[model samples]
Target chain A: MNFNFINLQPYSNPQYFIYLMIALIPIILGLYFGHRFKTYEAIFSIVFLFLIFDGSHWQQGVNLLIWLVYEFILTFAYQYYRHHGKNKTWVFSLAVILAIIPLAAVKYLTAFPDNSIGFVIGFLGISYVTFKTVQVIMEMRDGAIKKVDPVTYARFLLFFPTISSGPIDRYRRFKKDYEKVPTRDAYITDLQYAVRYLFQGFLYKFVIGWFFGTYWLPKITASALVVGNANGGLKLSWWVLAYMYCYSMYLFFDFAGYSLFAVSISYFMGIHTPMNFNKPFISKNIKDFWNRWHMTLSFWFRDYIYMRFSFFAMKKKLFKNRIRLSQVSYFLLFLIQGFWHGLTWYYIVYGIFHASAICINDMWLRFKGKHKKQIPSNKFTEWFAIFLTFNVVCFSFLIFSGFLSQLWFGWK
Target chain B: MDTKQGVLDILNDLTGEDLSDQMDENIFDNGLMDSMASVQMLLSLQEKFDIDVPVSEFKRAEWDTPNKIVAKVESLENE
Candidate 1:
C-alpha cells in the first residue's frame, strides 16, 4: 500500500551476486567455443543467464526460466513451420495467445488489492517481451523474413541489452544487420554514443524526473495555485507543469539511453540496432508524433497490429458496406494498444482520446478541403496547430500518469 | 459508371483534379500527386472500400498509375 519512494527500493541484495555469477557462466562458455557452437547455443547461454539473474529466489528464477523456455520453443516451432511453407496461422495464433496470458493474468488478476499473488506474477518486462516475441513469429509467418537461425533467433529474443526494457527490435530488420561485423571504429563510435546516452539518461532520471517526482510536484499541488494571487505573483503551479514537461523529456531520454547502451553493446558484438527516438517533441501532429517517438515500438504496433487488423477488416463484408468499419477498426487497434500498456482505466482512456483525435483530424481535413477558402495557410495557423497538439499530448500524459484523479478530487 | 470509369471517378475524388483522357501511370512522377497527397489517397481508399491499403502497397511501382490502384483494389475486393 505504500507508494512512498523508499518502499520501491530496487532488489539489490548481495545474494543477487550469485545469480549474476550464474548468468556470466554461459557467456564465458560461449566465448570459449565461439564458432564451434551455433547461434542457438549462444542464445541459450544468454537466456539462461537472464533466467538465473531475473529474480532473487529460486522459485522466481524457475518461473522466469519456464516463460523463457516457452517463448524459445514457440519461436523455434513457428520458425520451423514457416520455413516448410506450411499453414502455421493456427499455431502462431496459439503462441500469441499463450504469450499474452501471463501478462493479462498478472495485470488484471493479481493487481487487485490484498492479493498475495503479486510475488507470484511479476509483469515488469513480460508485456514488452511477449509483444516482441509474437511480432517476430508473425513476421516470419508473413514471409517478411526467412527462418532465423536458432542462436540468432534466441539472441534476438533474449538479447540482454534489450531484454529488461526494449526498443523492441523487429526480427527481419535486426537479423539482416546482425550477420554483419562492425569495424573497430564503429565500435568506438557506438561506445562513445552509449556513454553519452547513459549520462543523459542518468541526468534525466535522477536529476530531472526524480527531482520533480520527489520534491517539486508535491509542493506546487499543495499550495502554489490555491490563493488568488496578482498578475506578478509567482505561480509555482506553472513551474510544476514545466516539471511535467521535463519529466516527459527525461522519460524519453532515460529509455532512449538504455536503448543506445543496448545497441552499442550489440554493435561491439557486431549487431546494428535501429534508432528509437527521433525528435518526437518537435512533431507537428499526434500521428507524426507517434511516427517519431519510441519509433521501434510504434512501428511494431503499426506493422503487426494496425496493418494486420486493417487487412483483415478490409476482407469483411461490413467493412465493404460502411466507412465506419474502418474507423471502428482503428479505434479497436488503439484500444488494444492502450490495454497492451497495462490493464489500467487511464491507459484505455488515453488510447481512446488519441484515436478520436486522429479521427477528428482526418475528418476536419476532409471537411476543410470542401471549403478551401476557410482554411488558413499562414505560419500562425501552423504554429497554433503545433501548440494545440502539444497540449493534447501533455494532457494525454497526465491521464497516463494517473494525475487526473488529483485534478478531479483535489487529492494530491 | 463502368468499372474503369468508376475507378477514374474515385481517383478524381481522391486527387481533387480531373485525370486526362490519356492519363498514364507516369502521373505520380509528373508531380500530379505528392507524398502527403498519396497518403491522403490511401486513407480515403481504406475508408471508402474497407480495404487495408498499407503504405507498402503503394510503392513506386504500384502507385505510379491509377490503373494499378484500380487493379489492386479489385483484387483486394475479390480476396
Candidate 2:
C-alpha cells in the first residue's frame, strides 16, 4: 500500500460536516459509556472509539488494527507464561526482542535505499506505546503487577488524550485511579486546568515557537553566516549563544506544553497520567536535567533498560578486577539510552558526549570530598552550566534534525 | 565506612546533624532530605560503595529508611 498524507482540503469542504458528525458519534458514545460504566467497560468503549477513528482512514485503520492485534497477542502470551510460572527471564527477553522488532523495521529497514517495502506503517505514538507495553509485560512477569482485564488494557493503550504523545503512565497508576473515576466537581477543576494548559500550549507552539522559527532563528543564522565569512558558517557571538539558550527554552516549553495538555486532559477523565517535565531548566547538572526533563521517558529507560543491563553486567563480573563497575554501568546505560532515541552516528556521538560528561562529573565529585568547595556555587557558575548544557542539548538536536554533517562541513 | 554505621555516617555527612536513633527512612520520604540531600546521598552511594544508582531509583520506597538503603548498598556491593 502506498502512503498518502491526509488531504485537509476535504476537511474544509462545507459538505464534510456530515462526515465530521459521523466521526464524533463514536467519541460521544465512548465518553458517555466511559462515564456510565466501571473501568473495564470504559476501556472497551474507548477502544471502540479508537477503532472508529482508525476506520476513517483505511491504511491507518489497518495499521492500528495490526498494532492492537500485536498488543493483544503479546499480552496474552505474557499472561500465560506468568500464570504457569514459566522461565520469566526468557519471556522478558523475548518481549524486548518483539518490542524492538516493529521499531527497528520502521526506523532502520525502511531507510534502506534499495528496499521497496517502505510503505508507511503508522508510527504516530508507536514508540511510546510499544515501550509502555513492553514495560507492562516485563513488570507483570516480574510479579510487579497482575494481569489487567482486557478492557483496562485497551483503555490504558488507547486513552485518546495520551495516545498521540504521552507522559507514559504505568499500569499500576493507571489501574488505581481508573477504578475511581472522579466526581463532577473534580472533573470541573481538572477541565479548568486542562483548558488553561491547552491555551498555554497553543501560545507556546504558535506564538513563541513560530516566532522563533520564522524570525529570531533565521535572523541569527544570517548574521552568523555573514560574520563568519566561510560558506554556510554560523559564527555566533556569545550573546547569540545566550539567545540560542532561550530558543532551547522555548522548544522545551512548546513540546512540554503539549505533554502537560495531554496529562491534564487525561487527569480530568480520571486517568492519572505521568508528569513529563519537572523544572528541567533549574537543574544544576546534566544528571539532574535527565532526572527532571521528560521524566517518564527517563524513568522508563531506567527501570526497563538501565537497571536490567546494569544487573546483567554485574552478574557477569564484567566490572570486576580492572574497570570500575559504576563507570561501565553509567557508560552502557547512556549509550543504550542514546541508541533508543534513534540509530544514527550523530546520536551515538551525542550519547558518548553525554556519557563522558557524566562520567567526568562523577569522577570530579569523588576526588573532591562532599564538603570541598572547589566548584563555585555562585550565579555565574550556574548560568555557565546552563549555557553549556543547552548547547550540548541543542547540538544533539541538530544531529537529531539530520543537519549536523551539513552544518559542520560548511555545506548549504 | 563501617557497614553497620554507614547510614548514620551518611546522614551526618549529608545534613551535618547528629541523627542518632532518630535517623530513619522518613527523612528521605518526608522531604527532610530535599533535592540537595538526595543528590549528596546519590553521589556518596556511588563513590563509597562503587555502585551506580540511577537517579530514577531515588524514590521513597527504596531510600526512605536506613534499612532499605543499607540493603540497596549491600546488594550493590555483593554484585
Candidate 3:
C-alpha cells in the first residue's frame, strides 16, 4: 500500500485529520506531562509544512524558503534599528513597504493566467504569514516588541495548524503560549474544547456546508441564470435570491467550519488561537457583523490599517469633524479589505457595498443615539435589525460570490 | 488629578456612562467600548496623559477594564 503523504493540503478533507491526529499524539503526550519538546515540535512543524508544499507544490515550497529568509532579515533589521532608538517614520514606512512587496506581487500575479508569470512566487498562507510579519514589524516600531527572538519568531510564523487560512494569531500572544506548557487542568479543558470544535466543524463543513454548497448551490445557480436570462435586462429572478441565501449559508458554514478546525487544532497544541466567527448572521448591524465575523482579520485591519490611517489623517487635519473622520476611515478600511480579497471588479464592488452599508448603519446609530425617544426601542425592532442585517450581509456575500458578474455579463 | 480618574473620565466621555465604580468590569464585554471607541480612548489617552499608546501595543485583554487602562497608561507614562 502506497500513501501519498506529500500531496495532502491542510484540512482539505477528513482523512487529513486522521494523519494529523496520528502525528499530534506525541505532542499531546508531551503537553499532558507538562513538557514542551521544542526541538521535536519544530521538527514536527517543518515536516507538516513540508507536506503542504512538497511534491508538485515544490515551487511554492521554494518560494516559502526565499520569502522566509528576506522577511527574517527585514524583521531583524527593523528590530535592530528600533532597539538602537531609531524611530524615523520614513524608515518604518520603507520597511513596511519592503515587507509587503512579495505579498503585493503575489496578489497582483494571481489576477493573471497561470504560467504567465513564468514561475510561481507564492506559497500557501502567504497572506496569513505576511499578516504576522507585518504585525511584528509594526509592533517593533511601536516599541511594544523590543526583543525579537529568531527561533520564536520562526515558530510563530510557521505554526502549521492555522498556517493556511488562519484565525491570524498575534506574535506576542502566540510566543507567550508557545514558551509555556499549560497546566494539566488547563490542557484537559483545551482538549474538551478541541473535541467539541472538531465535531462541530464536521457538522458545519461536511454536513451542512455540503448540503448548501455542494448540493443546492449549483442547481440554484443554473435555475437563476436560466430564468434570469429569460426575464431579460439585469437578470432579475427569485432564483437569484435563493442562490444568495444558499451561497451565504455555504460561505459561513464552510469558512466558519474551517476556522473551527484551525482553532481546535491550535487548542490541542495548547495555544488558544482566536476564533474567527461568532454567530455572525445574528448580528444586529453591519458593525456588529464585522466584530463577529472573521474577527481576527477584521481586528487586524482595525488595528493596523483603520486606526493607523485614521490617526494619520487626524494628525494631518484631513477631517476636522470626528464623525466625518470615522466615516472616511470606514470607507478606506473596507475598500482596502476589498482589494485585499482580489484585484477583481466584483470583489471591489463587494467591498464598496459593505462600506456603504456600514456607513449607513453608523448614521442610523448616531441618529438613534441623539433621538432616543423618537426611535422606539423594543424586541421587535431588535429582531428587525437582526433580520435586516442578515439580509444585507447575504446580499453583500452575493456580490462577493461574483454571481452578479456572471448573471449579468455571462462571465466571472 | 491622577491617571485613574483621567482614565475614568475618558471612559465616561467615550461610553457616555459613568465608569468610576465599574473599574474592575470589562468595558468591552459590558458593551461600553468598541473598536472605534477604543481608538478614541487611545487618542484621548495621548491627549490627556501624554501616554502614546500605539495601536499595536493596545491588547484588548490588557486594556479591557478601566483599572487595566489606568495601569497601562501609568506604565507607559513612566517609560
Candidate 4:
C-alpha cells in the first residue's frame, strides 16, 4: 500500500495524464475485448478517487465519502417511495431539495468561510455529482427510470473522467454504455476520437489555454487597469476589449480542453459521453450560442429547469402572452444558472445580461420573421450576425471572467 | 380532420416544417422542435381543440413525437 506518489488535480497538468493513461490501459484493453471488467473498473475508480482526495485534500475526500453515502441513501429511499409508496409531488420536491441541500450549503459556505468551523462537506466536483444525482431524482419522477441499482448509481456519480467538470452524462445513457460493450468498429471510432481529443486537449489546455490564461490575460489586465487608473472611468478601453477576447479564449480553451479530456477518457472506457461544445463562436444569435456553448449544462438546464418552468407557467397561464411567459422563464433560468456559477454580483449580472440578450435576440428574430421580405438574408448579413454574436458572447465572457468586479470595486 | 392530423398541424406550426412523414420520429429527440415550442404547441392545442393537458402530466419522453402527442391529445380529449 505505497500511496507515496503526489496526488494531482485531475487534468491540471500534463503529468496527471501520465498516471491516468497508465491506470486506464487495463480498462481500455478490457473494453477492447468483449469484457467490461466491472469490479476492476470500480476498484480503479476508487483508487484514483483516493489519490485525488487523499493527500493534502484528504479532508475534502472524507467529505466526498460522507456526501456520497448521504446521496445513496436519499436516492434509494426516493426510488423506493416512487416504486411502492404514494406519488406525492411534495415528496419528490422534498427529495430534490434534500439532494441539493449539501451542495447549496457548501456553495453558501464558500462566501462565509469560517476558519473555526472547518467541517464543511464541500469538495471539487460536488456540483457535477449533485447535478447527476438531482437528474436521477427528476427522471424517477417522470418514471423514465424504473429500477435503481446502488452500485451503478455510485459508479455513475463518481465516474472520474467527468467528475470535476462534466459533459454531465445522463444516468440511463451512462448505464447503457457501461453495461454494453461497443462493437469493434464503433470502438475504433471512439478510440480515434479519444486519441484526437486527448492531443487536442493537451494543446488547448496546456499550450493555448496556459499561454492566454497565464501570460496574455494578465498582461492585458494590467494594461487595462492602467488605462482605468488614468481615466477613472468605467474601465472602458480598447485594451479592455482586448482583455475580454483574451480571457474568453483562455476560458474556452481551458474548459473545452478539460471537457475534451473527460469525454475522451469516457470514450476510451467505452462510455460515449456527450459533447459539451459545438463551434459556439459561429452562433448567429444568443439563443443559438446557448445551443452551441457548454452544450450539456445548457441542455440540462433547458430540459430540467427552463423547460419545466415554461411548462408550469403555460399550465397556469401565468402570462396572457405566450412570449412573455417564455421571456420570464428565460430570465429565471439564466438568473439561477448565474447563481449556480457563484453568488457574486458579477455572476448574477452575467446571468441577467444573457437573459436580456436572449430576450432581445428573440424579439429581433420575431421582427425579422415578420419583415422577412424587407430584411436581406444574404451572405454578408449572415457573416455580420456571426461577427456580432462573437463579440456579444466575448463580452458576456468578460462579465463571467470577473474582471469588471475588480475594476469597479477593487479600484474604489 | 382527425386528432393526429390536428396534432401534426400543430407540430408543423411549432417547428415551421411540413412534417408529414416524420410523425413517428420523436420531435424533441430528433431536434425538430424544443420544449419551448412544446409550450407553444400546448397553447395552440388548448385554443384549437380545447384539450387542457396538464404540464405535470406530460413528459417529453411520452409526448414529444407527433404521434404520441396526438395519442395524448385524443386521450385527454376523451377524458
Top model number, lDDT? 3
Candidate 3 recovers what fraction of true contacts?
Answer: 0.50
lDDT of 2 by residue, A124-144 (tens): 667778877887776776566
> Which candidate ranks first by TM-score, i.e. highest?
3
lDDT tens per residue, model 1, A218-302? 6644543353132233433564475456446556655665565555444434455666777777666777677777777877766
Listed in order, the DockQ scores are 0.10, 0.12, 0.59, 0.30
Clashes of each: 2, 2, 0, 0
Q: Write the per-residue lDDT of candidate 3 for residues A130-184, one digit (tens) a residue.
A: 9999999988988888898999999999999899999999989998999999999
Count clashing residue pairs in model 3. 0
The TM-scores, chain A only, for the candidates as listed are: 0.77, 0.79, 0.97, 0.96
Question: Could you tell me which 10 consecutive residues in candidate 1 chain A have the lowest summed lDDT?
Answer: A2-11
Q: What i-RMS does each candidate reach, in Å?
A: 5.9, 7.8, 1.6, 3.9
Better of 2 and 3 by TM-score: 3
Considering the two chains of model 1, state its CAPRI-style docking category. Answer: incorrect
Better candidate number, 2 or 3, judged by DockQ: 3
lDDT for predicted candidate 4 compared with the true structure: 0.85
Docking class of 4: acceptable
TM-score-best of 1 and 4: 4
> On residues B4-76, what C-alpha lDDT tens digit does candidate 1 reach at each position?
5656666787566677464565765544553444555666666677767655444445767777767777887
> Which residue pairs show collisions in model 2?
B25-B64, B25-B65
